[model samples]
Target: MAAKRILIVDDDADIREATQICLEITGEWEVLMAEDGVEGLAIAQLEKPDAILLDMMLPGMDGLTILKKLREQVETQTIPIVILTATAQPNERKNFDQLKVAAVITKPYDPMTISDQIMSVLLTSR
Candidate 1:
């Protein structure tokens, strides 16, 4: 079976690198990254990755806007989206739930367990 491909969209280079390293090493998944929302959205459309790990706060577009745009397009509508947030506020969580996001992973996450969390969320979402 082919390994799962995941796209991570975040402005923080450190977050993107750490996530890429962890997912690649621990989950054995292909990791694609984008530093800003515009690039992230473009990559999502072009790559069609199996899942998306999107940062809630971003430059140029923000996560909610990107999520809405992804949902509006047929090519990306069905892709599972896991939100990476520093603060999962009640209202934001509600919005994410309404948008049918896969999960909301709070930031400052444990690198050792991040892959497991992502994998588990994807499985349960399916």
Candidate 2:
């Protein structure tokens, strides 16, 4: 089978690298990355990745806005998005839930377990 392709959008270079390495090693997945929301959106539309790991607190376009935009377009609407954020408070979580995100993963996550968490969420979302 072909490897799953994942797109990770985060402004933090360290976080992006760690996640890319972790997912690539653990999941044997093909990982694509973007520094910010605009690039992320462009990649998502062009690549049509299997899933997106999006950071909630982006500099320009926030994760929620990106999510809304993705949902608005037919080409990328069905792609699952897993939010990576430091703020997963109840109210924030509720918002994510209402937006129909595949999952919300809190920041400072375990690198070793992140791939599993992402996979688990993707599976359950199906």
Candidate 3:
């Protein structure tokens, strides 16, 4: 099978680079990245990646807005989205759950297990 493609949308260059390095080292998937929501949305539409890892807080547009827009479009509606956020409040979690996001990953994530965690979500989703 072809390696799964993941589009990672984050405003932080360091986070993006770290995620890319971690995911690539596993050799199980291909990674694409965008610095902001606008670019992220464009890449998503053009690439149609298998999954999206979107940062909840962004400069151009916030993650919730991006999620809403993606859900509205037919091409992107079915793609799984994992929200990456630094906020881990219960209310935020509840809201994200209501939005039907695939998962919420807190920032300062475990580099060693991030790929495995994502893969687990994908497998179970199937």
Candidate 4:
């Protein structure tokens, strides 16, 4: 099978690098990193990665807004988007449920398991 391609959109540099290293090294996957939503959108449109791991809180366009924009576009609408949130608060949970995301990955996730977590959701959604 071809190596999976994943795009990660998070503003935090440390988190982005760590996730990239973890996913690339452990999962043997191709990883793309974007620091904000705009760059993320651009990459998503151009690359059409297999999956997107989106951070809930970003500097400019937060996850929800990015998700909406992605959903609106024909090129990116079908790509599985797994949200990463610090907490699954009741209200936020409701919003995510309504958004119908592929999955919600809680923040502070284990680097070792992040790839597996993302894979599980995307596989099931397929």
lDDT values for all models? 0.91, 0.91, 0.88, 0.91
Which lDDT tens digits does candidate 1 get at residues 3-79?
A: 89999999999989998998988899999999988898899999999999999899889999999999999999999
Q: Encode model 2's per-residue lDDT on 5-118: one tens digit a residue.
A: 999999999999998999999998899999998999999999999999999999999988998898888989999899999978888888777778998888889988988988
Query: Model 3: residues >4 Å from true position, as ranges?
Result: none
Q: Report per-prediction Cα RMSD to one decimal.
A: 0.9, 1.0, 1.2, 1.0
Off by over 4 Å in 4: none
Listed in order, each prediction's TM-score against the native is: 0.96, 0.95, 0.93, 0.95
Model 3 lowest lDDT segment of ten: 92-101
Write down the worst ten-residue block by lDDT for model 4: 91-100
Instruction: Sort every candidate by TM-score, greatest first.
Output: 1, 2, 4, 3
Q: Write the per-residue lDDT of candidate 4 for residues 1-126, one digit (tens) a residue.
A: 788999999999999999999999888889999999999999999999999999989997989999989998999999999999898788877877777689988878999899888888877998
> Model 2: how far is 88 from its true place, Å?
1.5
Clashes of 3: 0
Question: How much does candidate 3 score in TM-score?
Answer: 0.93
Give candidate 1's whole-model lDDT: 0.91
